[model samples]
Structure formats: C-alpha cells, structure tokens
Target chain A: MKMKYYSEAHEWIMIKDNEATIGISEYAAEELGDITYVELPIEEDDVTVGDTIGVIESVKAASDVYSPIGGTVTEVNAELEDNPGLINESAEKEGWICKLANIDVAEIGDMMTPDAYVKYLKSLD
Target chain B: MSDLEIKNTPLAECHKLAGAKMVDFSGWNMPVQYSDGILAEHKHTREKVGLFDICHMGEFRISGKAALEALDTIFARPVFNQRVGLCRYNFLLNKAGKVMDDLIVYRLAEEDFFIVVNAGTRAADSEMIQSQLPEDVVFEDVSDLTAKLDLQGPLAADILAKAGLKIADLPNYFNWTEAVINDIPVLLSRTGYTGELGFELYFDADKAADMWNYLLSFDGIKPIGLGARDTLRLECGYALYGHELTEDYTPLDAGYAPMLKLDDFPEREFTGKAALKALPVENKLIAITLEGRRAARAGADVLDASGTKIGIVTSGAFAPSLGAAIAMAYIESGKSLDIGDEVQLSAGRSTITGKISDLPFYKEGTVRKKL
Candidate 1:
C-alpha cells in the first residue's frame, strides 16, 4: 500500500514501491497566499535530507521547499513552470513537485503521518 | 507600536464578520484580503468594482487667512495658486529635502485645506507640518475623527448608482466635493492609488462599519484587502511610503524634482529649496518588468547587463492585470541604465532577468476615464 508522510516544514512525500513523490502540503500553499513562481529542481540532481531543493514565490512572500529525505531527483513537474497555481489547487496530488529515485525507506519512519500532520497544523494555530 | 498592543480600525469587526484575513499592518489590525483571496479581489477590481477600508490613514486640516502663503513655504510644490475644490499631489520634506511623506492636498475652500497622508507616517508628518505653519494658520489633526474608503474600478460609478448614492455627478479627476453617502457626510474625491477610475470617500469614523456594509450591499461590490491594494498601486508605479519614498532619499532622488518644479524657477523659495537645488540625483527610481512569471519582491538585488550591482529593488510583484512580473528599483545614477536594457534581479537564490521599462506597466487602467 502507498503511504504518505509530512515534514514539519510543510512538505509531503508519498512513497510507493521504489519511487517517492514530493510536494508542498495544503497548509503551506494556503499560507503562501497566491503562488506566483516555483523554482523546480533540476532532474538528476542530488539532494540532502533537509536541503532546500527549490524556491517558491507567492504574491505576498517567498519561501524554500526542502526535501524530506535524501535522494536523486528523477523528474520534476514541468507543468508548474507555466502554472504555479497548481500548488495552490492540488498541492498534495497533481501538484506533486518532483519524483525521487533510490528511495530511503528508513527515512520515511522519521516523517509524520497524516493524522500527526493534521494535529501539528492545529498546534501551529 | 509595541507587540503587546495592536490598533484596530473602526471597521475591524466588520472585516472579521466578512471572513477577511486579518494581518498586523504597521501595528494596525487590517485585512489583507477577504474570502475571495488576493487574485480574485485584484481581478474583480480590474474588471469590476472593489471596496477598500482605508481608515488607518491620517488626515489633517490647515486653514486661516494666511493658509495658502504658509502652505506654499512649507510644501515642496507651490500651493498658493491651487484653485478651490481641486486636489494636488505634494511632498512634505525635511530640511534636507528628503520626502517626509507624500500627501494629497485638497483645497476645500478659499482658506480651508485638507491633507491625507500615509497611515504609518501620520504622527511624524503631523509634527513636521505643524512646525512649519504660521501661528495664524489653524492646524488640526482630524485623523481620529476621520475614516477613508476607496471605491475603485471601471464600474465604480455604476456601483454607486446601483446603491443609490448620488452626488449630482462624480467630481472631476483630482478634485473633491462635499457629498453625502447613506446620510453620512463625506468629502468625495475622484482620485485613487489603484490607477482605476475610482473615488476616495472621507467620512466620520463612527459610521465606518455602516458605510462599509452599505457599499458592499451592491451586487458587484467586493471587499478588497491590502494585498490587492499593493499589487494595484505597484502596477501603476505609484510610490509607497516605506518603499519608493523614505526619509533618507529626497524627492529628487526619487524622481520628482522636475514634476515638483524643484529647480525650474530659481527665484522661488520653499522649505529645503536650497538643498534640493544643490543635491544631485543619487539613486534614480526606474520601473522594470521581469523576464518571466517569477516576481522579484522588494529588497532584491538589481544588476546591469554586465553583472554590476547598480541598484536595489524597492517594490516588486506580479501584475495581475498585465499577467507579468513588474518592479520598481532605484538604480544608482551615472550608470546610464536606459529603457530596454536587460538587467537581472537576484530574488532569493534564483534570478529574475528583465529589461528597464516605463512606469504604469498596466496601461489599461481607467484612472483618467471621463464620465
């Protein structure tokens, strides 16, 4: 079964088999106001567990999207280059930012589950 | 203002009732956007009508037999010949000619004038203006009793008519007239910072909430927040106080020397006239459009084609009306950065490459539309 995990920084990663997909959480997207630009990571680039993989610019402010776990960027959502609103629309699904290869299954344990993430979001309030 | 206390506008409760996102803006609790969000509010203002709560802004009154003469000596621009009922954009400067605040002076009558200034700079501006006026000129801070609202867009007049708020006819652009909105006396001015055909309403603070609801009762009137306000003004290249205008830079440094007639007539004298004439343009404000959809916000680094650090961005945002990223920067003089010259804006880690462009990036604005 596929499993989704979240980071305290508001990034979400969905793991299925050997491939993992990453995107910003809905809470992060809403908090960013209106998404204007998304600096997608280059394919075939290596990333650390907490490295800032790319940048996101909203109408009100800008922030960095960090990778939840270290892996190689297999592919990036090229559609976001023209329509960053996808992050605001379906942040957890079609708005998946990038794909990671050579997944670190053990690191997924360190991330928060869906239920824990929801509670964490409330705590922020 | 201390973090322990946040000031609330007269319509703050009404804003919450409409589900607006409240933010601490310059210590005042203000709405950044309503339920429809920034994009929708911004687009509606362009294609339809939008209402803005501007109660946090400050207002002052100066009147006496010698009001004109005293005001002429105090203001950077000559205000003696300004006709009654007309409003003029002016600059209040310190001894060094730097802009203390940019304001609009409304000649309410022969010896009566009303001034509007930025909300954050109200206190200092009031003191500085009071210091310059002659003892005979009566000066009063009307900010506490006054509240401001803006009805802006192409269909602003239609919205007013729909709500049955008639003023015989809308005032001419840059002019104001005494009128009544929903039985509340208001000074209606045909001027706005959004570059849209709009009206600014000045009324009693106590009736602010009632007035807000009365306007929004119209079918197409949307409650816009400060977020869209920033984008709209930035697109028109209007200067924001902390951004394009500040105490450190003179009006000439900010590109208003020629418009203000700073050195045009060497014979005339005003506050800081000598310093203004002697000072050379330091960093010149120029408008630039980004090469892509990425917005280069304020505080970004501006570099020329050869990768020289020439200036820093004062204001930047994605122009909702034009569907492009636009910015204003103070490029240091002597670099000769001409229009159409390519430059790079270091916005965080990524760079937004763009060319020097003219102001009012969104030209379709209806600010000058004749009724």
Candidate 2:
C-alpha cells in the first residue's frame, strides 16, 4: 500500500483499516548514512503525536524518531536489532518500525502527502 | 559565508556532485559519507579496499642545522636516532603534561624533517613548534600546499602495484619513500589509521583531483568518506585527536605509557618531560564491548555492576566486523578491570551491558604484515 502521510520529522505512515504502520522515510535513511543501532519503543507503550518514541543512530550522528500519531504501540520490528540496514533498503515497506492499532484519524491533517513532501524536500534545498 | 574564510579541497565539487553528506569539520566543508552509506564503506575497507580524502590533516616542514636538536627537545619521541627514510610517532605536549597534539615525524634527512599533525590543532601545533625552535631553525606550514589520501585494505598493495610502484620496494611500517605517481611528485608512506595494509600519499594540493580520479579508475577502489574513516579507526582502537587524545589528556594516560621512553630519553632535556614525570596519572583508557547491538557513544556514563559511576566513554560505535558494539573510556586508575569485567553504559532510558576487553575490538588486521 502507498504511504498515506509523511511527517516533517521524516517519518512515513501507511493507514490500513484504521491501523497504521510507521517507519522513517527513504530520504531520512539516506541522510542518516549508516544505521548502527536503533532504540525501539516497547510494545503497548502509549505515545502522543509528535513525541519521541525511538532513536536511530548512524555512524556520524544520532536522531530521534517521533510518533506521527497518538496511539499505543502494538508491535515493533525486532529484525532491526541485527540488521538495521533494512531501513535503508526498504524504508516505507518491510522496514516499518512499529504498528499502532488505534491511531487518531485527525492526525493525518498534520502530515504531508507525497506531493507536498516532495515540495517540502525542495524547500529544504 | 565568504570563500576567503575557509579553504576547499580539489575534490570539494566532486563530493557535492556525488550528493555527499557534508559537515563543518575543523573549518573545512568535508564529506562525512557518500551515497553508498558509511557501514558499507567501512566493510569494504576491511574486506577489499577503500580510498579516503585526508587532505584536512596538516603538514609542516622544518629544515635547518638546529631543526634536529630543536625537535629532540620539543617532542616526546626520539628524533636523533631516526633514519632518513623512517617516521616516528610523537606527541606535542603542554607545560603540565597534557597532550597538545600527537604527530608523526618524517625524517627526510639529518637537517630536514616533515611533521604531520591533526587538522583541528594545526594552527596551535605550528605555533608551538615554531616558538620552541631555535632561531636557526626554519619552519614552514605547508598544509595549504599539500593534500593527503589514504588507500587502505588487504588489496591496497596490489592496487599500488598496478599504479607502477612495486609495493615491496616501499619502506616497512612507519617508513616513507618519495616517488612520482602520474608524474606528480608524491610521498608514499606505509602508515594509516585503519588496521589494514595501507598507504598514505601526499602530493601537491593542485594535483589532488587528478590523483583522486586516477585512483578511482581501479576496479575495486571506492571513495570512502569521513564517516567510514571514523568507524574503521574506532574498531582499531586508535586514539582520535579530540576523542581519546586531547589537549587535556596525556599520552601516558591515553594507554600509551609503554610506548613512552621517559627513562631512556631523560625528562630533563625534553619540553614537557618535567611536568609529565611529576604529574600522577589519574585515569587509564580502556576498551569495552557491549553484549548486543546497542551502542554507548561518547560522553555516555560507564557504571559497574553495583551501579557506581566508573568512567565516561570517549569514543564508541557499532563494529561491523564484530557484529557487536564497542567503546573506549577513561576510568580511575588502580581499579583493576580484567578482560571480562562486567560493565554497563547508560544512554538515556536504555542501558547496555558490556565487558572490558583489551584493544583492538577486531583482530586479524594486516596493518603490520611483513613485506
């Protein structure tokens, strides 16, 4: 399924039947350079919109991954522990970091569509 | 920012064209990594070969009758006994035994010497060397006129051999030879920070682009950036200037006490020897390996099993070679931590368990192989 929304923090989320799967965008992974370690949030942890839920470290720098929607984390990708580069290979698909079952539908209003994200990236340059 | 404020290397535009991640490092716009990614570049350096643009490092030339005698007193390492083709690692020290900078001294001749220093401490190192030199010594900061490149890995020798230089003819470890690569006068040294068989080439800054492009034409060579350069070095347990070895830490306290020759060289004759001998070493640098993939980075707190704050991490990263996280830290001396001592590092809400191991984190390196 196509990514339904993107956050300014570089996270992309796909809405599927009221639930959402979230991961950092390919652009963010490319900028991070090398994924060394990831501090994923625990399952069932309550997260607010725009709150830092995890950390991603590259060889050069470290960045926080923010929750794009208010929800409780239902599942986390344990495969990232041994193979963090999956985020670089398939950021929006297989590399999704976590899944939230009860995401707020109104949170989509604060996110950007694919077209707007492309424009946002250009504005950065 | 104006162009006059900082200098750009010949490969600056090339880096931009390749979509490199740029960062302001020591007043230079350096590429931290290219599109291939830092971990891939680091693994390539270990398995095949990797090329690095190390032009940011500083170079200086000292020539005169007093140059030898002046350096003998200025640096911690011995200079008089060094042969013309050899190089020695030495430290520039402050009055209170703190390390100003760690440098490599290339003895060109009895009266001529070349000093390679860190990029961040170039200005201060130059001033310190000049001020300590006798009036007869002639010192020139040749950093602007020179550029350095490091070709490192198991295949480095084969790559250089294809470039028309017999790798065997080059000097052994810590030795250098002045040669011509592509008709550009270059100095090739059998030295590098990565724990691999490598060569460091120094040539005219203007010809850096030609040399860089020439090397990239090889089949297995790729342009690795500063990000990989850091991981490769960190895995080798080499002391980085700002992280492990700094103006505030002495070489002795930075796990180089055995390398120091205070008794043989005599402290009274050296620049900072008196203070170094008088000051008691408070902390000792140690290596730690985490139990899992979670890394504890610089400034992270190191604690014992009982939750006592034992030290602070100086440099830390995930080792691609070992598939584990490793770090270096300075802890209080006289507290014995064996090879398998249990330790924990706290990074915000998460804590990582690790064990004390003697450096380097990765063994089987080809850095000191016999020619």
- Weakest lDDT window of 10 consecutive positions for candidate 1 chain A: A102-111
Candidate 2, residues B77-147, lDDT tens digits: the string is 77888899998899998888789999999999889999999988998999888989888899999998999
lDDT of 1 by residue, B1-371 (tens): 56458889999889999999999887789999987788889999998999999999999999999998888888888788799989999999888888889999999989999999998899898999888888899999999899899999999988777756663577989999887778899899999989999999999999999999999888888999999999999989999999999987888878886678755666667887778778777878999998887888888999987888899999998888877899999888777877898999998766779999987788899999988
Worst 10 residues of 2 chain A by lDDT: A1-10
Who wins the TM-score comparison?
1
Number of clashes found in candidate 2: 0
lDDT of 1 by residue, A12-66 (tens): 9999888889999999998887888889998999887888888888888888989
| Cα-based TM-score, every candidate | 0.97, 0.96
Inter-residue clash pairs, candidate 2: none
Task: Please state the Cα-based DockQ of model 1 relative to the true two-chain complex.
Answer: 0.81
Count of steric clashes across candidates, in order = 0, 0
